[model samples]
Target: MPRPEALVRRAAAAALEETGARGAITVLLADDAAVKRLNGRHRAKAKPTNVLSFPAEAPGYLGDVAVALGVVRREARGAGRRTADHLAHLVAHGALHLAGYDHLAAGEARRMERAEARIMRRLGRPNPWRGAT
Candidate 1:
């Protein structure tokens, strides 16, 4: 597998291609505390999450994707997945969000999951929701 940073860039590019979206996305690898602060400030949630996406307000700009290193590592270990693989999944998820995909509803979530699976597969990564119920 490629390095974590490479995987992130690959995943983001794949997601953009999968969604036929234009522009570029900025990826930020941050610690848990920083992510927690961002989550609290922007999302009104005072906890660290795996990933967060801030879509660009202007046209021709994709958006920003932030990943919490500590949280991601912990979650990947708990799930028995490789760190790079998990990071790729998170990057893809955030990129999809930038492409205007949402999982707020069941139907929307299913669609998003399917899209993510396809994108990950194209990147030579495993299906993130393979065993999901």
Candidate 2:
């Protein structure tokens, strides 16, 4: 497998292509504490999550995606997936969010998951939600 950073970049690119997002997106590999702060400040969640997507305000810019290393590692272990694979999934998920996909509704979730599956498959990764309930 490629290095983690490489996997992340490739996944982001694939997601952008799938969603037809123009311009650029920033990827931040952050620690739990940093992510926790961001989550609290931006989302009011007061906890670190595996990934967070901040969509750009303008049309030409895609936005930013942040992943917490520690949280992601723990989640990947719990999910019985490789760290790189999990990271790739998160990157794709974030990109999808930047492209205006959301799971706030059931139908929207299904659509987003389908897009994720397709993007991951194209990146030669396994379906992240294969056994998800």
Candidate 2: Cα lDDT at 96:
89
The C-alpha lDDT values of all candidates are: 0.92, 0.91
- Per candidate, the number of residue pairs that clash is 0, 0
Candidate 2 on 60-113: residue-level lDDT in tens? Answer: 888999999998889989989998888999999998899889999999999999
Q: Write the per-residue lDDT of candidate 1 for residues 1-133, one digit (tens) a residue.
A: 3457778889999999999999989999999999999999999999999999999988789899999999989998998898888899999999999999999999999999999999889998889899866
Every model's TM-score: 0.95, 0.94
When summed lDDT is taken over every stretch of 10 residues in candidate 1, the lowest stretch is 1-10
lDDT winner among the candidates? 1
> What is the lDDT, from 0 to 100, of the residue 103 in candidate 1?
100
Cα-based lDDT at residue 93, candidate 2? 95
